[model samples]
Target: MNNWTRKHNKFSVQNRLTPTARELWQWLLDEMPEGSNEIIDLRDFNKWVKRTRGFPHDRKTVKSAAQQLLDKGVLTQAKSYTAYVWKWRLQPIRVLMPPPFRKPQKKLTFQSEIPNLDPSNPQPLKDEYLTTTTDLEDAESGEFEQKLQACRKAGIYYYPKDAQFMHGFSLQEVLKAIIYFLFNRDGVRHPEGWFKVCLEDNWAGKEKERHQLRVQWSTEGLFEAIRYCNQKMGMA
Candidate 1:
């Protein structure tokens, strides 16, 4: 067996070292050889934990902790190798003592006062006309049904309802049901009116107003409405 020395005091789970995880780390340090950059087998660490630390640890625990330490810059793995080695860059174990108490962070609150608003600023025009049209032709022609099905399997609902309708259902209830499945059932964002137009024009809407509206619908309203509708339909 390799001889090892304590680089730091044993970390405690109860005494402010309560990260719970660092306790295991302390155990690892206790078992490690001093001033040496040698590969520590996970099996050895587990055995050490079981015997000296009186803790129940398995190979998985050792592996997970080793990986976590490596990720946190506490340990470094060799290049072109699978095993991990401790980084000598870590401060000497003496710094592992309990941290000093910090004052609790203060929560901030604000009070609002009503101010008179200027109504002279003109607002942009609200255009109801769609810049692009819904591409019912391709969707209705089973153009992307496979993709739709894959999305369904992945629980990514919220495709256009026409995709379902063209598959052989006409009723509004059925339409709503499909909508529910995509938006509510799988939690996908539904295409808004602008997106519908974009899809119809193959995503070539010219008017800025039309484009802006579509963007809004696609981002804000579509997904939520789909979710709400799906919930109402008991799909979710």
Candidate 2:
């Protein structure tokens, strides 16, 4: 499955918001569904906010974030019946589109419009070496062994130096991602060399995908988890 939250993942960074403001704003984006008119009474919201880490039901902090979004045209607030009812709005996701056609000087070639066939592009390539079942088995024969060995050898060369990283991600988790990438990606000239590169990003893209599907989770899933924690702590 494709990443549904990918577009929203970097929201705070893209908006250049302060840490507290970003948290509050992101809470809004994640609290209600996109393109939704679900209005939260400021009082109820502040009650919930008190259960969170930052902003803590502070009207000044909350309003500051809401106004920032308003000024940036990212959200809107409404007042009706002489009550301060605020609804955090989300901008419709903007998709990148190429400009309208610019007529070519002498018409284009079929190859020009398509992306180059680079492994970095992550497109699947035809396996000219693996035609028959025997050939396929031979190709993958020692690949996993090599990858597992590499994983062990580089046990210290990964994130979560201990299991304290997010959700207890550790060496085994890293190896799983490496193995999946090895099997699914374009041809790798060297297993060890390829895995070395994967370690840089901690194979986070793959882990996030798995987490998304496993929990059927979205940003809102974060809220549910937090709420549970808050309840256990007698804060909610």
Candidate 3:
């Protein structure tokens, strides 16, 4: 696997890693032979980044990042000083979109004023809206059930009210919340509580943003690889 190279491939949870942390991980995967332990000296990594990544990182910064990775379980400290070991893990779960969840509805325009309407009569409008949107309600309910089952599979149980609250968001957004929970759940003791807070604060959007950033970073890496190859061919 030493010569194995993957390009334009998506990482399991790229947004969870900082730049230095990610570089350190890549360095471990590259420099450490399989079933071997090596000292994680940042000075050597500094040279590597200068030569390959076209940038330089201070030893202190790299060391701090390494420590952070250790604390986060991304790297394990070996018995020897400064030496570390890395492990491979399964990829994150992917959320598959089922058939069109809901049909788009035409825009609704409310009248400036309604004549012959009693101020005390509130049931008519509410009942009419519910009747008109029954199909939409059913679609959203089905989608909510799908997301609930997914969370259950991931061992994230949501209460009845919690499920109702989550139903307010799109299924894709809710799934992002689940992904966020799974990726960053290293020290979380109460997953259900964490998920409830996540829903209340709408952390799903943050996950979506991270996903976008990961895609952008991956694209940049792909281009950098291409440029490196071009430079090497030119030298040859």
Please list the residue runs of candidate 2 whose C-alpha ends up more than 4 Å from where it truly belongs after superposition. 1-4, 54-57, 77-84, 95-236
List, residue by residue over 1-236, the lDDT tens digit for candidate 3.
13222210112123344445555655666666534455555577778866743456666667666766555554453343434222333111121112334444434455425697554555576687768767665765687789888889878886543344454456786777888788888977777767756754568776678889787787779899899999999999
lDDT of 2 by residue, 17-62 (tens): 4433444445565567555665655555566555532324346756
Worst 10-residue lDDT window, candidate 1: 124-133
Give the best candidate by TM-score.
2
If the candidates were sorted by their TM-score against the true structure, best first, what order would they fall in?
Answer: 2, 3, 1
What lDDT, from 0 to 1, does candidate 1 have? 0.40
Which residue pairs in model 1 clash with each other? Answer: 132-197, 157-182, 158-182, 194-214
* Model 1, runs deviating above 4 Å: 1-20, 33-36, 52-55, 77-236
Q: Is candidate 2 or candidate 3 better by lDDT?
A: 3
lDDT of 2 at 129: 23
lDDT values of the candidates?
Answer: 0.40, 0.48, 0.58
